[model samples]
Target: MAHYARRRCRSACAGKEVSLMKKVHVIGGGLAGPEAALQAAAAGCEVTLYEMRPHRSTEAHQTSDFAELVCSNSLKSESENTAPWLLKQEMRRAGSFLLKEADATAVPAGHALAVDRVEFSRRVAEAIAANPRITVVREEVISLDESGDHITVLATGPLTSPALAAELQRLTGSDQLAFYDSIAPIVDASSIDMEKVYFAARWDKGTADYINCPFTKEEYDTFLDALLTSEKVELKEWEKGQYFEACLPIDELARRGRDTLRFGPMKPAGLTNPKTGRWPYACVQLRQENLRADSYNLVGFQNHIKYGDQAKVLRLIPGLENAKFLRYGQIHRNTYINSPAVLNGTLQLKAHPSIVIAGQLSGVEGYTESIAGGLLGGRFAALLARGEEPVAPPRQSAHGSLLHYITHAEAKHFQPANITFDLLVPLEEELRKKIRDKKERHRLQCERALEAWGAWLAQSALPVG
Candidate 1:
C-alpha cells in the first residue's frame, strides 16, 4: 500500500515543469515541517526545509534530529474504523512520508502506533536529506516577509522560536495564544514491581502492551492526597495559569477533584486485574517508551511538579513504589495562533495567502493531526505556486474535518483539537436514528469519510494510490 502511494506521488510529479522561482520555504524540522517539505517536493516544487536545531534548540528537544518527538513516542491509536485510524489511513493513501517512517520504526504498543523516537527522527531526517528536490538548511528563520517571492510554510510547531513567534504576532496582528503543555515522566522498567503491575491493553484489543498498576480504594485515596499536596514547579509571573485541557498536569487534575484522576487517566473500566479477577478502584497505565522496553512512560500523567515532589507522589502508586525515574515530567509553553482569525480552510494565512501555517502552531493537536496540516499546507502551497486553485479535502473526511475545525471554529473560544468523531460532520438524520449505537454511528461515519475521501482524491490533483 505504501509503495503504491509513493509511486503515485512520483507519477503526479513526473514530467511536470517546476518553475525555479516557485519554491516552497518550509520552516522548522519538526514533524509538520518535514512532512510539508516532502509533500511539496513530491508535488514538483523546490523545497527549502529550515531547521533551527543544532544551531538553536527548544525547551523540550534533546537532539538535533528532524521530527524529534518531545512529549510522547506514541502517535495515539491505530484501532481500525476510529477517527485517528481513519486519518492515518488517509495519510497512508496520500503517501505521508512521516507516516511511512513511523510504520517502519513502530514498537510494540498494542493497537497504538508508537515508534522508537530516536530511530523515527533519524529515518525522517535521512529521507529529507536524500530527497533531491528538498534542501535542508540548518539555521533559524527569525522573520518572514510576506512579500517574498517564494511560498512559505510556517510549520514551526508549538515551540516556535521567540523571534519568529513575535514576527508571527506582528503579521497576524494578534498575540499567539499559549498554554502549558506537560510531558509525562518515564521510569526504568526494571524498577517496577512486576507482581503488582499486570500487562493488558484496554479491553484486550491487542497484545497486552500496557503495564497496568491497579489501585484499591484506599491506595487511590492516599495517592490522590499526596498528589494534591505535592509541591509543583512555580510558573513565572507571566506564565501563571493557562493549560490545554487535553494535556492537563496531573497536579491540576488532582486539584479539579479527587475522582477526576480516576475518571480521566486512572480509570479502570476495562481489563480485569489478574490478581483480583475484577476491575480495581483505579489504575495507572505505563506504556513502553521504545522498542527496547527498558523504560515506560507514565501514560497521561504529565505534570509540572518539583522533581522531588513528583518522585514522592508518583511512588505512591502500587507498582512504582520503588520506581527509578528515567525522565521527570516537566511543563513548557505551547504556542499556537487563533486559527479561525488567521487561517483559511486551505491553511493559508488570511492576511497573507503566500504564507501557510501547519502543525500545533496552527491549533491542531496530536502527532497525526499536525502531519495532516502539513499535508494540506504543502499541497495547497504547491497548487498556489502552480497558479492553481487549492482544494480542501471533503468535509466528511477526517482531514477536512480537522481543517474546518481550526479555520471555522468559534474564534472567541478557540482551542487546539485532536481528531475526534465530534469534530466530523454528523451522520445523516436517518442514519443516526437507524444506528442508535454510538460506536456503530462512528463506524458508519468512518465508512462515509473514506468513501468521500476516495472520491475527493479521484477528482482532485492530489496523488492517489
Candidate 2:
C-alpha cells in the first residue's frame, strides 16, 4: 500500500527536487509533535508544526510551551539492561530531538531520567522555533487534509482535544478509543513540613534525590480512611472504567484494599527513616518539580478526587501538613486510536498513507514511548514525502517491537502499552535456557536490540546518530 503511494508521489513530482515538492504537516505540539517536526526538517523536508496552546487550552496543560511533561517529570527507569533503557538507547541511536533536549534539562531523580519540565519544554520550543526548515503554527488542527497534497503526522498525545478527536473518528469510523488519565499535584517546597521529611533514594541506589515522608501505621490508617471517603470528580459514563493500569489514581488504589497504597505507591521497602533509624510503616516520596528545585510533586499521587476534599486527604501524609498546592490532581480524557486496526507497520493510516499516526494517539503509553513514536512517524513521513519507501525498524529492536505490537496486536483487546521486556520479541529457547537469570536474559536482549538498531541506522536513507 505504501509502495503505491510512493510510486504516485514520484511520478507526480517527477523532475522537481523532492525537498521543494512537499511539506510535512505535524499536528499537536506535545511530546511527539515537536520531535516529528524536528526529525522531518532534519531529513530535508519543509515542515509546518501545529500546536493548539496559548490559543486554545486543554484541561491539564498549564503553559503555551511545546513538549510539556504534564503528569510526571520522570521518564521511567533508566537503569541499564532494562526495557525502558533499551527504548531510549534506540532513540538516541536515531538522533531523536526530544531525547536530546530531555538530557540537557535533566534533574537528579536517582536512577530514573526525570527532567526540569519547564526547561525541557523551553529547549524543545526553542529548537523548533529556530529551525530554518520548520514553521510553527499556534492553532488547533480540528480537521486534516488527506488529499495527498502533503504528509500529515498526528501526534497529539493523550489529551487530544475533543473536536479533533471527533473529526478523527469521522475520518476513520473508530469509536471506543479513549480513557481517563489523572494528574499528580505539585506542592510548594517552602510549604512542606521538612522536619517530618528526609531526603533519600530507595535502597540508597543512586544519590538521595527523593524526599521521603515517613508515616507510622496510625498515620497511614488515618490517611487511608480519609482517602477512601474523598469525593472524586465524576467522569462521563464511557470513561468510568477506562483508567490505564500503570497510571491509576491514588484513590482508586485505596479502594483495592486497606494496605494497597502502603504496598504500592507508598511502599517503604528500601527507604530508611534517618531519625527513627528504620523504615517507616509507609511513605510518600516527593520528587523535585523543576531545575530550580523550589517545588516537588507527590510521586504516584495522580487522583480524581474533588479539589476541596482532595487537599484535605493528601495533607494527611506526614510531611504534607499545611501543604500549599501549586496544582491539584484532576482527571482528563486521553484519546488513542486502535492502531492495530487503522495503522500500518510504518505508523501510516492504512486508509491514508500520507498520514502518520503517532504518540499516545497511536496507542503507545508513557513519555519516552511517545517520543519514540514521533521519531518513527517523522522519519516515515519525511521518506514518503521524498517519494521513497519507509523502511520498518528491525523487529528485534525496541522501536520495531512497539510499532509491531501497535500495528499487529489483537484489535479488540489492545490497550496502549509502555516498553517492557515482555513486549520485546522473546528470546529463542536456546538463549532463554542458557541465560538462567531473568536480569541476564533482559540484558542480552537489550544488547542484541541495540546491535540490530545500529545496523538499521547505518542503512537509512539519511544519516542518524
The TM-score that candidate 2 achieves is: 0.95
Residue-by-residue lDDT tens digits, candidate 2, 312-358? 98889888889999998877888789988988899988888888988
Query: For residues 1-465, what per-residue lDDT tens digits would candidate 1 score against the true structure?
Result: 121111112235576643443678999888899999999888888999999989889888888889988888889889988899999998888888899999999988889999988889989989998999998899999999697477899999999999999999999998788888868899999999998889999999878999999999999999999888888787786585789999998888889888999899899988679888999999999998888889999989889899999999999999999999989998889899999998888998888888999898999999899888888888887877665668889999999999999999999899999999999999989888888999888888899998998888788775642
| Global Cα lDDT for candidate 2 | 0.88
Local distance difference test, per candidate? 0.88, 0.88
Off by over 4 Å in 1: 1-21
RMSD to truth, every model: 5.1, 2.6
lDDT at 283, model 1: 96
Distance (Å) between predicted and true CA of 199, model 2?
1.5
